[model samples]
Target chain A: MSDALHDPGTGTPGPPATPVLSATGLTVRFGGRPALADVSLDFPRGRIVALIGPSGSGKTTLLRALCRMNELIPAAVTTGSVRFEGAELYAPEVDPAEVRRRIGVVLRESALFPGSIFHNVAFGPRASGFAGDLHALAEEVLAAVGLWAEVGGDLDLPASALSAGQRRRLCIARTLAVRPRVLLLDEPASALDPVAAARIESLIHSLAGDVAVVVATSDLRLAARVSDVTAHLDRGELVECGPTGTVFTNPRSKRTEAYLTGRIP
Target chain B: MTPLATRDLLGTACRLGAALTLTAAIALLGVLLVQALGVVDVGFLAGAPSRFASRAGVGPAIAGTLWLAVLTAALSFPVGIGAAVYFEEYAPRNRLAGLAGSALANMAGVPPVVFGVAGLALFVRGMGLGPTILAAGLTLAMLALPTVLVTSRTALREVPRGVRDAASALGATRWQVIRRQVLPAAGPGIVTGLTLALTRTVGAAAPLLVLGAPAFVTHAPRTPGDILTALPTQAFTWSTRTEADFAALAAGTAVTLLVLLLTVNLGALVLRRRLR
Candidate 1:
């Protein structure tokens, strides 16, 4: 157990690699009621972190805060610091748009634009002022998501024509087109069926090599299946954080144990 | 009566009421058409207004109305839609925003004649523009502005939040999200609103009258500053002359205005459908 803490499954480490994103004493209040309180965590590069909690446990708020999206809410007040690549995300000099560009957030509902599928995928690159070939970028991202074969020939079709699973992948492709370094997914599979959910889980696992992925989910089994690290949040507090296997089998906190065993209610 | 019989009775009453309303509308249009049919001709359409009612034509009035509609649309659409975008997308959700939104809603319901008086004060006397087509057009634009703003705000608000979030997630600036996603999604509604505003402006007689649009103009307006008479004003003038020929001419002018309005509305319908 002592050796397991040092061995993060990646063999070559004297110490853990510096996280791509880190939060220190992060607290968020919306109209003076706390949504998240004093959350401090690190998201390492090339890893999948699952944020599991019940509804209103601040899982989504924390994910949004990382990319400074919480600011979009009118009364959302955030204190403390979120650093992405060693720069404060909420710094006066930092642009939220730019931060979101580097750290893409994929919402549960497939939010495709009311345009052609090709345009939906190309939106990110075009908005980011990508000077490269837009068509090629769309093709590349679509292929990465394994959606090119189905949607490639019908690039002119409206995005609304896609099925649920296809729309979800198209959204992922949209995010990938911008070439983000960190990907935050809020319940990416909650709206999907089991087969589609499994596919999305595998997709998230596959994406770990390219970007640091944080998936906020209420599904504990999904967290156990896909995440390298699991963080349990309850009532706006981080109750436990550890390796996925250890946390599920041997939780440090009674709250986490009760939650896993269906005793929290 | 049994509950089932009561439901049937209510349904029958609703159907009868709808039928009556539709029939009344058709009957009124039929009367207007019968009155208008005799005076409408190529000669009446093409000839300029004259002292002789039989020789008078609606050509100048039609042209003036077209010019007013175009200028009013051009002036109002951009400004009104811009204001809507500001209120819906850019304005912070605060008391000031709430107050401004309420004020705009109230403006939409203000009497058209009040807008005419305002146009009279602001554009004619204040700007020294005289009672030219520009002043009339500006007055009609003011009348249309509130309708455009209110309806456009509704259109913009109809854009789904998820679509906006998707654009923002793609790193689009606030303006880019609105331009690329929100506006396009809201396009059909916006077009519908603009069509309604322009149609209302074209049918307006009071504001143009307040602006002192000429009852008779010799030539088609060549510029915004040219003196002009619109269709409603022309029809009103002809109706008041107490001559049977002039009354017939008024009905003809009304039919022409109706046709013009229908054409504009149909074009807008096609545009809105295409946007959808």
Candidate 2:
């Protein structure tokens, strides 16, 4: 357990030392119903922030808004501002594709393309017009996710043949192959077994120093175990946010405390 | 009866129904094969049509049909696939898009003769393409375009939304996602649809007839502009003739057309299986 990124004391999070991405009063509505309402947060570089909420807590919606993926839904309307590094994400001149490349997202379904495992990982780089050696890059990322030894020899095999956990790892590897600066994972391990989930948690922990990570999960124990910072959302609103230890042990909001203790309906 | 017995009885009934349909199709094919066996010789395929039925052949018609099939496929497949990609991926989810979708669906069910009439007015007279293979090819392409578009749209829709979102999240532009992910995922279905459209166009004579495809041509078409006669037209012409041998030649031409359709369909089947 590396405590290098975790703050020592339990307290509300002050202004981040180096904010990689920040949302100020971001609100999203679908068909006139709010999915995320007046939510504001900062994701600092080299840290993992866990978003914990029950279903329909706007966790997924916030992640999608960060990457501008919410635009894919025709009825989704987003307001307020999202800034990555220093630039407005929804600026007229900003390309959503470029934003996605910089801030990669791993969806809950772990959608792997219908091709070889190598091709699945290589697809991102190739689509972004990567000019360097593709094979070496793919190998490097696959190894990073600890999939090289098992799938290296048979990179040509269809990705659909892999088990659920392997497929999830492959999705992460594919995102990493593009060398994204920020990674947003929506329940990356919720569907996996305990062992696999732990492996994913550790992998995410190890990745914090190189890339900022925001993980949205329903599992509070997983959040408590892995996150340096935790933000609790309820009914499309931010309920409480602070250092993980403080938020878990002494949440200021009754809603957050009830939800954490399984009292909320 | 027990619930399990009732379930088994329903399943057996469905199986029997399917078997009966297959049996009927095989029986029809057998009859056609028997009728076509004796008259469909090398000369019947190689020689040109003549007043004397035994001397007549389908070489020119076969060449014309091939030209029409190739040209129509070259024109329709890409355009139809492009339209389908637009509708499935890029089109806005608005009332206009909805209206266009319904219009496209209705177009798929429009009579082939209606397309033929439109092609006659549009390409033959309006464009001044004249009654040449080019004109007929364009006409048949129009006839098959709706089916290609509709089937291609369905195929593109069949690609998982998750696969599309994954590609987009990896920074692929809309075109890149469609080209690299959606298109390849839907390849087998698109190929199957295109093959089926080509088969239908190849068998159809009404469109070409509307475009004034000649019933008899002695020489094979050497270029798109050359006047042409297709297999179905030749078969139709011969079947209407008074000579008994001409009727035999008609069956032979039908057999030749059937063989060409089967070869294409079988090739598509093999391709689809390989893709899967």
TM-scores, each model vs. reference: 0.95, 0.93
lDDT of 1 by residue, B151-218 (tens): 99999998888888888888889889999889998999999999999998879888888888888787
lDDT of 2 by residue, B126-224 (tens): 999888899888888888888999999999999998999999999999889988999989999999999989999889977878888777799999899
lDDT of 1 at A205: 85
The parts of candidate 1 lying over 4 Å away from their true place are: A1-16
Candidate 1 residue-pair clash tally: 0
lDDT score, candidate 2: 0.89
Classified by CAPRI criteria, candidate 2 counts as: medium
